[model samples]
Target: MAKPFKNLRDKMSPQAQNASEEKAKKMLSEMPLQELRKARQLSQKNIAEVLSTEQANISRLEQRTDMYISTLRSYIEAMGGQLDIIARFPDGEVHISQFKEIESLQNSKSAQSSG
Candidate 1:
């Protein structure tokens, strides 16, 4: 026996969805790598080890304040996650499909090395 997933689109009120999406975007913009890594139960040393780099390199990445979207994508991928970007229109209406597309972009960016 298992519970089926709920339809998030049907469940979310327009106001709630707007606020939640805005919050997500703001958080992503300000998020530090250290917090994300810790939340994933990973350490800088662990990531450095995987990347074949020194632990100090991980420390610098964690302290980085500016996020290059491409870099963020790769880092997130290494943690078994992905980054996304979305836009809100003049009426504050966001397309639901954009979420999925953004995820694909993240995957592609991570896979690319010369971008």
Candidate 2:
């Protein structure tokens, strides 16, 4: 008879356990944009209305492998979620601000006005 599936997590080392947990978290958090939209139970027509576009446009957008950040941001916001850009290096990961340039301009204006 075939052996039944075994839960090997109990026998894993602490480091292995941590690594597994991290992998699980990453898998749960990330997926294709179309999958994310469908998982939210949103229709293409619904997203099109939010973006003031046609359903066909939304459909085409989902099929695309590349798109502008603004387009992605708008689509994500339509699905009631925020998009974050991350930079990963050997040392660590950095969450890049979406509006850094705009924020910097505002900060500069504030400093100028205060001066």
Candidate 3:
């Protein structure tokens, strides 16, 4: 025995329904990692395939409290996204470039070793 789901919007006035719809849209836009992936029409399997990892690892990655920038960048890039780091202060915000520095450092080290 299961109860049927009702359309709550149907009971609302037109204006109220419109407002509710807008709120719902905003909330969806601010969803967490798992919801964002689903909203993008992707599954953990899809992400795992792109990252060359197992589905369980993707789930664990999403649940992690903190992760390395390189690891996060790999996950985001696999999802067709570019990761950006920003710093915000009372004055304003600034885009951090340390992530790029990691690449530059590696490149310089390799060049030195090769030369």
Candidate 4:
């Protein structure tokens, strides 16, 4: 009684198929932090352990709409991902390098403090 989705999709025009694929790609590209974490197969406890914080803190951080860049960077790093700050313009997009520099500085400071 039910048709397979792949068979239905095959009946679509090439343009329609391409549009559907593009929409799916867009959906996969953007997601909230909570969804991203789950997609990466990580739990709040896992991130907390890597970040040296409590699980409650990780939960609170994921719910906030606003947070410091360093805080966000640390959270993303704990999940084994690098955070990139991108500035989109009418002409093109630019990747902001200042945050990368900040991360390097923090790493150096941490190394010095530990050693």
Predicted model with the maximum TM-score: 4
- lDDT by residue (1-115, candidate 3, tens digit) is 6544356657779999889889988998676677778878899999999988899999998888798998888787888988889999999999999888996787799899999
Q: Model 4: how far is 25 from its true place, Å? A: 0.3
> What tens digits encode model 2's per-residue C-alpha lDDT throughout 56-77?
9999999999998768878998
Residue by residue across 2-115, what tens digits does model 1's lDDT show?
Answer: 544346645889998889889988887675678878878998778877777888977887788786665666677778885666668887865456656766786788789656
Model 2: CA > 4 A from native: 1-27, 98-115
Alpha-carbon runs more than 4 Å astray in model 3: 1-26, 104-115
Worst 10 residues of 1 by lDDT: 1-10
Q: Which of the predicted structures, 2 or 3, would earn the higher TM-score when compared with the native?
A: 3
**Could you tell me how far off, in angstroms, the CA of residue 50 lies in candidate 2 after the best superposition?**
0.4
Off by over 4 Å in 1: 1-31, 93-115
Clashes of each: 0, 0, 0, 0
TM-score of 2: 0.64
User: Cα RMSDs of all predictions?
Assistant: 11.0, 7.7, 4.4, 1.9
Top-down lDDT ranking: 4, 2, 3, 1
lDDT of each: 0.74, 0.86, 0.85, 0.94
Q: At residue 109, give the lDDT of candidate 3.
A: 95
Structure candidate 1, residue pairs in collision: none
Clashes of 2: 0
lDDT of candidate 4 at residue 111, scale 0 to 100: 100
Note the residue pairs that clash in candidate 2: none
